[model samples]
Target: MPRVSFAPPSLCLTFLPLLERLLPSLPPTVRDVDVPPLFREQFILSGYRPVDLSWRCYVLSLFQIHNETLSVWSHLLAAVYVLVRFLMFAVQQGGGILGVGLQGPEGQGFSVDVSSLPLVLYVFSAVTYLSCSAAVHLLHSEQTHHSLFFLEHVGVAVYQYGCALALCLYSSDTGWTQSMLGQIFLPVVAVVVWLSCIICCYADLHFHRPYLWHRRICQVVPMGVAYLLVISPVTHRLASHNWTNTSTLPLHFLQVALFLLSAVFFSCPVPECFSPGRYDIIGHSRQLFHILLSICTLVQQEALFEDFLWRRQALVREFGEERLLLACASFLGLTLCCVMTALVMKRRTHVQLLQEGR
Candidate 1:
């Protein structure tokens, strides 16, 4: 037998500090005053990561204490969970690009055909936005912040379109679907969503810290219009729904409430506003917004899934397969337009950065 040798305690102690030094350490964070103005958060005075860190350091910062840590992990984990759930659902239905059917209330079977395209698109959009948000939060540095911010705006535009597409196809009441608004809703929504992205990017580019009010207005107005337009179907559905049938009603209500509350937190910094630096590492408004929005998304998904199962046959027969494919194709076109807009804005941002000697 070979004798096993263990290092003595003294020898181990001597190497401990050296080993620690050899390993990558968490980068030191700075105060709001120390970093560039673009990196500072309103009412957040400390725990700001330095602007000029290597890509590896920023990736490592995910596990370290910083203002964006919670923001990053919150949406990152939500995206992963949603993706895993979708995969599991697909496996259960049938291991294919298109599943046969899903078991619904009381074990009723509903067909999954091209009619399922909207649901798939909505899930893809949700994952895209959530992943994009996480990436923006994780990799945001002075060098990449502008391009990433524009990317985030594009994600929002895509998500809005996704929600509109699903609600229009699946959740709208029969009466509403036949109404005038429904006839022209999707085309108008596509344009509005693109405009919202452009407005958001423009606001960020032109407005600095002092023009916060103008920036907020420019950002909020277009988004509010797009949101109202996209959510009209759901609003109409909820209002016209029979209260006696309480199956998916509660989920709709919960999703709406969560979304509204999240908007409040997103627009206004709370607990942190009251006491600066107190919530820098925890319990900030943005963190709350991310959590609430994620929950809202999950609830919305469940409600939509239930609605899809209940109305699949009617939807397919009424709209026909051609219309369904057309709607999806139109949405794809809108996605391309939004991506182009982001790229153009990103190029403009790079030019501006160079001009400013950044």
Candidate 2:
């Protein structure tokens, strides 16, 4: 026989068998996988080890099939859906932020300056969708346990930030005057308290940081309760019988509650999380969150639209032009936030990965 070329024991004896056993299929279960020699050699030469990269890649691999594929596409499609709706609204009612409204006869639909309000509202809603979409895609791809745990919350933060901005704009536009009760609670204080509650909830989930024995009092329950306490009073005032044309409390309260509920749904992760791998590719917590979020966004748009109509018909009808323009601005901001956040995160992750690769 021809002389056999000597192979290194590490390569011949160690890695060959492992390679034969692993990596044949795209979505092979890898919780207990052995490192192949080629990859191991790369690691040794680079003086680094796999830092959950494989798992991250593996989890993201679900995009090809498994459970999370539908989840990913669901939000991706939802983003597209929102974009279409926003565009339709813009086309039907032309004018930029601060535009004139439709003032024509009943049949004509000729308008005054009710333009900007729609656009601005659209923008805020778009931001919410984009942030949510990015979070889903990124987390799905995140294989390492730590990556999943850390990046997951970022999505919620994005969602909350968008809502906060929207609420702030509403507060200013409608001149949500502070009452004595509100003075005692304060907007700034409310925000701080909500943020604190959110942070505490996240800590409980990831860090297993302990809390009071009353389980119901922990996590989302506390958040919901705190929300009611801080926001309810103002919402109640807005909805109170004494109010007439301008108060935006009832609609605002409804929108805010729905938004909060969406977040809670995301955090609690019912149905799928309970089933685990059964919903890995579809019907997962993230997917449900996306659906609820979309509905919430649509509801919010309607609420904002109603507010705009009220403002034009009754409150400060003088600036129909300005209101329209403001709406457009808001729309642009919301739509852009989604695309912008995705690009930013992509760039950041790419840079970090490249640096790590080096």
Task: Name the top TM-score candidate.
Answer: 1
Stretch of 10 with least lDDT, candidate 2: 39-48
RMSD of 2: 12.8
lDDT of 1: 0.86
lDDT of 2 by residue, 158-271 (tens): 344344433433333333435454343334433544453345334534332222334334445545554454344436545554445544555665667666767765566566
Superposed Cα deviation of residue 208, candidate 1 (Å): 2.1
**1-358: candidate 1 lDDT, tens digit per residue:** 9998786789889998997666567768889999988888889999998887877778889898999999899888888888788777667756432434555668587664677788889899999999999999999987787789899999999999999998898788878998999999999999999999999999888887655688988987898899889989888877988856856777877887898899888889997999999999899999898989888888888887787778777877889988988998887999999999999888898898889997
